[model samples]
Target: MAVPVPRQRDTPATESAQATPPAVAHATAPQASLTLLVIEDDPAGGLTVPEILDADRHRIRLRTARNLTEAARLLTQDVHCILLDLSLAGTPGGSGPGAGPGTAGAGTAVADQLAILREVLRIAPRHAVLVLTAEADAERAAEAVRVGAQDFLFRDELDGRLLSRAIRYAVERKRADIAQYKLAESKLRAQENARLERGLLPNPLLEGSDLRFAARYRPGRSRALLGGDFYDTVRTPDGTVHAMIGDVCGHGPDEAALGVELRIAWRALTLAGLCGDDLLSTLQEVLEVERPCEEIFATLCTVDISPDGRRAGLCLAGHPAPLISRPGRRAQLLPYENSGPALGLLPKARWPRRQVELGGAWSLMLYTDGLIEGRIGEGRERLGQDGMVEMINRHLDRGLSGEGLLEASVTEARRLNGGELTDDVAVVLLSRTDG
Candidate 1:
C-alpha cells in the first residue's frame, strides 16, 4: 500500500520559488525553446505533464521513455533536460537498462532510488537531470539532488508550469557549470604554458664576460610564447663566448620542441668543448633520432667569440650569415661561402669554422631566416639580406644599440610587411665595448 504524502507547492511565497523564477526567465530568453526527456516505467499513465510554454511564449517539446534503454536512444543534442521516475525496478541491482553494476546497498529502497539517478547522471553527463518521486519521499528527493540531479520533483505536485520552470532553471545551471569548468581549464593551461616558456627560453649564461647580449624572439603561431626558432648565448670556462641561432623546418609545437632540444644540446656540447663540424655533426645525430620524420632538418648559425673580444669563429650550416656592424662602418653580412648543408640533410657534413677579425667595439647579429622573409609591401618582393642590412644601418645611424636595435629591427620588419611575418623570428646580438 502506497502512503499518500502532502503535496509541496513552490510559489512566489516559497524561498525555492524565489531563486528559481529569475534564473528560468534569464535562461529562457536565449534558449527560446527546449526539449525535455521524461523517463518512467508507469504504463498506468499515473504522471500527467500539461502543455508548457517558455518565457518567449514558445512551446517546450517533451519526449517520454519507458526505461533507461529508450532514454539513452532519445538522448540527443537537442534534449536539454531529463526527468527520471525513481520507482523504476532493477535500478538498485544495476540490472536496469544501460546502468552500470550497482555499488550501493541492495536491500534499501532509498539506495535503489539514488542508484537510478546515478545511472541517469552517468548516461547524460552533459544534460541537466531531474528526478520524480512520491511526495512522501521528500528526503530521498533531496538526496537525488545531492547525487547529481539538477532538481527533484514530487509526482503529486507536478504541473506544467512548475515542471517547465524547473527545466529552464536546470538547463541554465548546467550551462553555467560547464562554462566555469572550461574557464578553470583555460587558466590551468595558461599556467602550464608559462612554466614551459621558462624551461624552453632560458636566460643567457654570460657571467664574467664583457660582451653585452640582446635577443628578440617571436613565434609565427598566434598566441604562442615559443616557436621553431631558438637561440642561446653562453660564455664557457675557456673565456670563449658561444652564440647560436637556429630554425626548424616548420611552425608548430613539434618544431618548437625540436628547437628547444637542439638549443639545449648545443649548450651542453659547447660547454663540453665541442666546436665547428664536430658539434654540428653531433647535433645532426640528435635531430635524426629525435625528429618525427626523416625529412625534418634545421638551419644553424654559430659564433664563438675569442677571449680578447677582438676575433670570433663563425659557422653557418645552410643558414644566413650574421650581420657585423662596427663603429663608423656600415653593417654587412659575414661571408657565408663554403657553408655545409643544414643539419639532418647531409651525412658526414663538414661545417667549416671561419675565423673572422672582429675589430674592437663591434656588434654581431645572428638571426634565423624569418627576419628577412617578410615582404617589403603587399607585393611579392621580400625584404632580402641587402634590405635588412640597409635597415639596420639606418637604425644604427640613429644611435640605437643593444636591445633597442633588435626591437627596432623587428618592428620595422613587421611594418614593412604591413603585418606580422608568417614564420618564427629569432635575432641575437652580441656586442663588445673596449675601454
Candidate 2:
C-alpha cells in the first residue's frame, strides 16, 4: 500500500535564492561532540563562544562559569575538559612554595593560577585543561603548559573545530604523560630500594673460618629489595667468631634502616669484646636512641664460637631459637628459656646466655620468622617447628650441608607459600666440620 507524496513548489525568486553560492561548495568538515566548561567572568553578557564542532560536526556542550568559585562548582566528574579565560577577573587559589623562578610579587597572582591548574591536575589526573589566552599573551599560554596544563588555545583562532581537536589531543596527551610519569617514578623508586638493600643485607666476614657459610634473604614487601630483616657475621682477633640475625616488627624502609643500625652496633660491640649481656645491653641502648618511635622493637639471636671451634654460646632476645644438627643424629632446637623481650621494649631486659655443645662436626642455622610462617598447603596450619625439623632432616640425609642447607630451606618456604614468602626471610647457616 504505497502512497504518493506531494512536493511544494517555490516561486522563481525563492528558487534563485535557494541556489548555492560559488564558495558554498568549499571543502566542509565534520565535528565531534564534547562536554566542555568555559570559565569566563563577563556577568553582563554571559559567554558567547562560537559553536565548537568536532570532526563529526556535533556541537560541543558548553557550561559557563563567571568566576573560579563557580568553575569549581561546575567541575563535576562528567566535565571532560576546562577552558579557562586568562582575562577572568578573580585570582586563582592555593599556590605552593615551589612556584617557578621569576614569579615573585604580583607574579604571585599568576603563580596562584598555575597552582590552581596543578590542583586540577591532581584532582582530575586524566582530564584535559586548555588555557584561553589573548593573541599577545601567547607566551604565557606556553608557560601554562609547562605548569601542567594540557594545551593552550588563542582566543582569536578559537573555533568549534579547532577547540574540539585541541580538547581531544589534550586528553590523550595528559593520559600518556601520567602513565609515563608513573613509570619513571617506579623505576627511580626501585633504584633507591636496591641501593638501600645493599646496605641492609648481611655480609659474611668468615674469610678464614673452615666452616662453609651460606645464606639467603627475601623481603616481604611486594617488589621490595629489603625489609626489616638483618644479619651479620665477623671473626674477631681472639679467633672467636660472632654471628647474629634479627628482625624488626615492620616491613618499611624506616624499619630496614633501624635494622641496619642495630646490626652495625652489634658488630662494633662484638668486635670490642662485648659479649653475652653487655653486648646486648649496649645494642638495646642503641635501638632506644635510634628507633623512630617508642613502639618499635627488634628480635635477635646471636652465636659466638670459641677458638677451638668445638663449643659455642647462644643468646636470644625475643627471637626464634636456632636449629642444630650433628653428623649422626637428627636436628634439634636448642633449649630457649628465660629469653628477654625484644630490644627497645624494657630498659633492664635480660637475654639469657645458653651453652650449646657443638661437636667438631655440626651445623647451626639462624633465621627470621618469615621462613617458618608460610602456609604448608591450602590449610590454615603453618609449617611450624615440626615441619622445619623434618625438612632439615631430609636435607641432611641428602648430604645437603652448609650453604646448600640454607638455599634448600628458603626455596622450600617459597614453594610452600606458592610463591615468594610474603615477609622478609633472612637465613644464615654456619657449618663447622672437622677438615
Candidate 3:
C-alpha cells in the first residue's frame, strides 16, 4: 500500500527558473469529468494515485502507462491531461519500447531526465501535461514545467485534493492558450484580406473628365473580400474615358488572381494605345498563357466614350451588353450584335467593336452575369436582363444616382434572392452630363 504523502507549505517559486508560457484568453469551458494519463516505469502498472475528485464531486478517471510507447498509444482525444513521472525519463527501459540502445546514451543527465516528458509533449501537443518528481528533485521538476508541462508535482506532497486542483487549473490554462492562438491567427488573416481587397479593386482614373463613376463589388465566397469579377475605368490623353468589366470562369482564389492579372494587362494595353480587336487579341493571348488550365476563360465588355460624350465604341466578348439610360427614354440594353466568344474559347476569335450613339447626359451600367442570374422567387424564373433593367428603372425613378443607385441595385438583387447571391458580382456606372 502507498502511504499518503503530506502536503508541503510555501513551495519554492519556479518563475525565476524559466520563462513562463504566454497566458492565453480562455475561450472554452472546462470539462465536466477530467481524464488523466499517468506515465510511470512500473511494469505492473502499480503507481499509487489518490482518488481525485472534481469541484462537483465527480471522480476523475485515470489511465497508467509504463513507458513512452505505451503513453503515446494511450494518448487519445478524450484524455484531457497527463501526469508523467520524471524518474521515467532516466529509466533504461523507459526510453520507449523499441527505442534503440544508443537513444538512452545520447543525451546529458538533464537532457535524458527530460527526454520522456519531451516525447510526451511531441505526441500530445494540445493536451495539458503535469510532471511528477521527488521532493529532492524540485529544481528538475520546475525545469520540466518550463520545458512544456502545464505544472510540476512533488510526490512527497501528493494528495487527492492537491492533485485534483492542479489537474483542473492545468486544463483551463491549456484551453486559454489554444483560444489565444486562434484569435491571433484570425486577426492576421483579416489584415491580409484587407490588403488584397485594396489591391484587387479598381481605382478609377477619371481626372479631367466629366464622367461620374460609381462601382459596387461583392464576393460570393463567405469571408472573402474579392473574387473573379474585375473592372476598371480610365481617361486617356485624348480625353476619351474607357471602362471595362470582366469575369473569370470560377469563383476561387486562383480565378480571382487571374482576374487581377487581366485587369492590369488591360489597363497597360489601353494606355499603350491598343483598342478594339487589337486589344482583345492581345488580352486573349495573355489569358491563354496565364490561365491555370485550357478550360478556364473570361467574358469581357469594354466601352470607350468619345471626348465629346456623344458617341461611344462598345465591344463584347461573350459578355452582357451595358444598359443605357437617357433623360427622356427608359433604360435599355445596348446592341450586342457582332460579339465574339469569350477569351480562351476560340483560338482566332475576333471581338468586333460596334459604334453606339450615346446621346448627351446618360448613365451606362456594366455588370457581370452574377447580377442577372439570381432567382426572383421560388419559381424557376430568373432575374434576367429584363428584370435588372426594371429594377434599375425603379431605383432611378426614386431619384437615386451614383453610389446610392449602385448600392440600392445590389441590395435589391440580394433581397430578391431571399439571401446572398452565390456568384461574385461587379457593377460599374459611368454617368456623363453634357453642359
Candidate 4:
C-alpha cells in the first residue's frame, strides 16, 4: 500500500524558465526535520548538493553515501528519502572488472550498478527515491524515474529549496502507504478470527430428540475468540445418545487449544465403544500429556441416555451434577455421590458413574460451575446447587423449554450477579418427551 515514488532526473526538455530549472516547490506549511541519504560516486565531491543554506537560506540535514554499500548500511527506518546516483551501480567489493558502462569492459559494471539501484529500491520500498543524473542523459533520467524514483534532479541545478521540498513530499507519501497497509492487515485478521470462532461453537446435534441445549461462554482473556469451554453430542451406532460439556482451566489460546484436544479425544473414545470409567480414565491421561501445565485441570459432566428414553447414566469429574425435572414434579439434583476429582488432579482418581431412572418423559440439565457460582445477593454466599433448582422450578411453571429455558437461566444468573459472568458457562438439556 505504501508506494514510494523514487526521484529521477530524466525530463525530455527543461521545465525551468531559464536554461537551468527553477527551484522545486517548498512546503507551504512548516514541517518536521527529515533525514536524507545522498548516494553518489564522485569521490572529489564534484556534485555540489544543497547544504543547510538553500538559495533562500532554508536549513536541511544531510548524510552522504558514496555507493550502494554505504546506502545499504544507512537504510534505517529513519532515513526518509534517498538521492541515488545513476552511475554508481553495484556493491563496492562485489564489483569485478568491466563494471562501468563507458569503459571498454565497463558494460557489466554499468548493468551491475543498475542492479544495485533495483536492490536498494526493494529494501527501502517505503522511502522516497530521487535520481541524480547529468542533464545531457535525459533518456536514462526518464528511465530512472520510470523504474522507481519520485522526481529527478540534475546535478548542475541542485539547490537547497528543491532538495527540501522533495524530502517533505517523500516522507508524507511513505506515511500514507504505511497507514493503508495496516488497515488492510487489520481487516484480514478480523475476518480470519471470526471464521475460527464459528467452527469452535456449533449448534446442538440433537435434531430428533426432545432435548433443548442452551449455553453461554465468555473468555476471561481480552480480545480472544474462544476460551476452554467445550461441548458435544452424538447418537451412537446402537441408537444410544451421548452428550458432554467440560471446562479447561484458564482463559488463553493454550487453554482453548487443550480444550479442543480433550473434546476430540472424548469423541474418539466414545465412538471407539469406550464409556463410563474407561473413557474418562483415558481422557485423564490425554490431558496429562496435552495440558500446558501440571496445575491445569478440567471439570466434566457426561450423560449417556438410553434409546428408550427412560434411563441415563451420569458421570462427573469434579463437576456439578445435572438438574432434572419431570412434568408436575419438583426439580432436584441428579445423584452425585462418589464423584471423582477433575482431570489432571490425581494420577489415579476414580469417578464412580451413577445411574438415574428418568421418567417416561422428563428433562435433564447439565452445566459448568459458572452457572451456579454467581452471587444471589450482595454477599459472599453464591447461588449454589439449591438456588439453581428453585430457579428452574419457577421457570418450569412458566412453561419455558429448550433455548428459552437456557436463556432465562443465564439471564437470571447475570441479574443475580449484577454483572457478566467471570468464568465460562456451558449448559446442555436432554429431554425424553415434549411434555
Candidate 5:
C-alpha cells in the first residue's frame, strides 16, 4: 500500500497483454469527483491506480488499505466504490479467503477463494465493489457478482481507462438495482393492502331485502386504504337487515385489523339469529379477545331493522347516535339514553337496546366520530354534531340522497377541515322508501 502504484496510461503494457478499450472511459467518466478504495495485500503495484484520471478527465482519488481492518478505517460515505484483490491472503487469523473459518475444507474452495470478497460485502453493503482476480478465474469473478458485488475486473485487462469506466458503471448499476428493488417491494405491499382493504369493506348481504344501503370509508394514514374504521351490513334469513359501524381507538395496522374482525363477528352473529343485548355482548367479548392491547377499545353502533323495514332496534356502545331523516320531518339524533361503555372497557357491560319507530319512509345515517370531529375551518371550532346536522340539512335541501349524500357530506367535511382528515371515517346509510 505504501509503494508506487501502477498508473495505466503511464505504465507500458506488455506485448502479450490484451488491448484496453480507450473509449469506455470517456463514456462512463463520472461528472463529479469519485473516490475509489483499493484493498489488497500489495497496492504498491498490484494494480494500476496512482494518478489514474477518470473518464471525465478528472483525477480519480485513491485510498489504499493493506487489510480489512485498515480498509474499514478508510471506508467512509465519500467512498463511492471498492476495488478488492481476490488473491489477497487472509488476515493474520484464518478468518478470510485462503483460510477456512465457518465451514470445513470439503467443497468450500469457491467460498474460500471469495472469502475476502464476502467480508467486504458484509462491511460495505452500500458501496459498489469490483473484484480483482486473474483472467483465468473468470468463473469466480462472475460468482462474486452473484454474491452481491457490483462488478469484477481482471488484473491483466485492467488499465487506467478500464478501471475508471468499471468504477462508474458499477456505481450506476448498483444505484439502479436498488431503485428497482424498492419499486418491486412497494408493488408487493400495495397488492397486499388492496387485498386487506377488500376484506375490511365487505359487500352487504341484502340480496332479498328491500332496504337500500350506501357507505363511505376513508383511512387517516397517508397512502393507506384501510385504517381503524370498519363497517358491515347483512340481512338475516328472517328478512331482518342488520347494519353496524365502529371505530377502534387507534389508526394503526393493529387497530384496523381488529376493526375488521369486530365487523365480521357482528355480521356472523346477526346472521346466526343473535340480536339486541345478546348480540352486543357477544361482540364485546370478541373485541376483548381480538384487541391488540388491554387499553385498546372500540366505539360501535349497531341497528337491526325489523322485517317491515319501518322500525329498528338501536344499540350504542359509547358511539354517536344515528341520525334519522324522515320525508316531512327534520333530521335529528335518535334516542341514545342508557348506552353502554365502549367494548373492551367494561367486563360485563350491558348495552340496552332501544326500540325506535321509523314511520313510513326514513333514512338512518350511521357514522363514526371522524365525520363530525374535523375542524370546521382554520379555527379550533370543530364541525361537531350540531354543525353536521346543519350541513346534512343543506345537502338534503339540495335533494342529495343515498351515495350522493354520503359523498357530498364527507367531501364537505374534508374541505372544511382545510385538507384530509386526520382520522378514519366510516358512514353507512340505510334508507327505506316505502311507508
Candidate 6:
C-alpha cells in the first residue's frame, strides 16, 4: 500500500502566505509528511527498489513517471523531493527529438545526456533533486551534482535507509540554500534603499549663516525613508535665510518624487533671486506641468528672514502658518489670514507676502499638515491647529528647543494618535540667536 503523504498544494494565495505577512492572517501549519517523485522507465516495471521508509518508519510515498511527459504531470507542490534516473532516455519534458538538443548540430553527447537533468531542474526550481545512475557513470553523477543535483546514488548502493536519509537531507539542504539566497537578496536591497534615501533627502545650504537648523521627518509607509512631505533651508548670497516646507497630495513614490522636484525648484528659484508671489507662481507652473495628474495639488509655507534676522516675509499657499517661540512668550502659530488656495487648485493666483517681526532670538517651525492631522485618540477628534499650538506650548514649558523640541512634539503626536501617525510628517525648525 502507498503511504499517505499529507501536503498542501500550491495556490497563489498559499505562495503569498509562505512569504512574511505584513499583518495578522492565516498561518501555515508544518507539513505532516514528505513525498518523493521517482522518474525511471524499467522494461518490466517501475523503480525496482523496495518501499522507501522515513526516519519515523512511516513509508515514504512514491509516484513513478516513465517519461518526461509523465514526470511533468507528477511535478506538484506536494512533492517535496525528486529521485531522477539520469540514465533513462527520452526527450526533454516530452518535447523535441531526444537524440541531441543543446547545441545546434551536436550528437547525443554528454551535454544531451545532461539536458534532461537541466529540464528537470528548470521545471522544479524549489524542490530538491537526487540522481540515480550506474557505478560506471560516477563521473557523470558528480557532474550532475555540479549542475544542480542535491546528490547522486549508485545503483548498487541504493537501499531503503540511505534514500530516506538522503531525501530528508536533500530537502533540508535545499531549504538552507534558498534561505541564504533570500538573506543576501534582502541585504543587497537594503543597501540600495540606503543609497536611494541619501539621494532623496536634501542637505541644507546654510553656509556662513548663524541660523541653527534642525528637522524631523517620518514616512507613514513602513520601511520608507522619503515621503510626500519635503522641506529645505538655504541662505541666499545676499545673507538672507530662506526656508520652506510643502506636501504633495498623495502618499506614494510618485508623490514623494514630486515633492523632491518642488523642493529643488524652490531652491533654484531662491538662488536665482525669486521670492514671494513670483517664486510661488513659477512653482505653480512647475506643479501644473510636473504633477502626475490634474487633480494633484501641494500645500506650501515659505519664510524669508531679513539680513538682520529680526523680521521675515511669510507666504502661505494653503499651508499652515509657522509656529514662533521666543523667550518669555508661549509658542504660537504665525498669521495665516493671507493664505491663498493650494497650488494647482487655482490658476493665476497670487500668494501675498506678509511681513512679521521675529524679535531678537526665536525659533520658527514650518511643517506639513501631517503633523496636525493625526487623530487625538481612538475618537474622531484630530490634533488640529489649536491642539498643536497647545501641545507646543506645553513642550515649551518643558524648556525643549531645536531637535529635542521637534522629536518630543512628534512623539507626543504619535502617542495621542494611539499609534504611528498614518501620514508623512515633515517638520523643520530654524532658530537665530542675536546678542
Question: Model 6, range 91-202, lDDT digits (tens) per residue?
Answer: 2332234433563432344565577788888889999999988788789889999999999998888888888899999999999989999999999999998898778888
Model 1 clashes, total count: 0
- How close is every model to the real structure, measured as TM-score? 0.80, 0.72, 0.84, 0.65, 0.82, 0.84
Query: In order, how many clashes per candidate?
Result: 0, 10, 0, 21, 1, 0
Candidate 4 TM-score, C-alpha based: 0.65
Best to worst by TM-score, what's the order?
6, 3, 5, 1, 2, 4
Alpha carbon lDDT at 390, candidate 6: 95
Candidate 1: what lDDT? 0.84
**Local accuracy of candidate 2 as per-residue lDDT tens digits, 1-435:** 111111211211000011222353244532234678776554344335676654445455677765445566767777778877654532322122322244354565555556555655555666788888768766777888987788898888887678878988876787788899999999999888677767666667777777778788888987767789999999988788899999998989899888888888998898888999888899999998988999999999999998778889989999999999988999999878888788888989888788878888888889889999999888878888778989999999998887788888889878887887888999888888776
Candidate 6 whole-model C-alpha lDDT, 0 to 1: 0.83
Over the stretch 285-365, how does candidate 4's per-residue lDDT look in tens digits?
999998878999999989898877778888999888889998989999988889989999999888888888997878888
Residue 405 of model 2, lDDT score: 80
**Candidate 1 accuracy as TM-score:** 0.80
lDDT of each: 0.84, 0.76, 0.84, 0.74, 0.82, 0.83
- Scored against the true structure, residue 211 in model 6 reaches a CA lDDT of 88
Q: Assess candidate 2 and give its lDDT.
A: 0.76
Displacement of the residue 235 alpha carbon in candidate 6, Å? 2.0
Model 4 CA deviation exceeding 4 Å by range: 1-42, 46-169, 194-204, 250-254, 289-296, 308-311, 323-335, 357-365, 369-435
Supply candidate 3's per-residue lDDT for 325.
94
Which parts of model 5 have CA positions greater than 4 angstroms off?
A: 1-32, 43-45, 50-55, 90-109, 221-225, 292-294, 326-330, 359-361
- Which pairs clash inside model 6? none
Clashing pairs in 1: none
List where candidate 2 sits over 4 angstroms from the true fold.
Answer: 1-34, 44-61, 90-126, 219-228, 248-258, 285-298, 307-310, 326-330, 335-362, 375-380, 395-408, 414-424, 432-434
lDDT of 2 at 218: 81
Candidate closer to the true structure by TM-score (higher is better), 2 or 5: 5
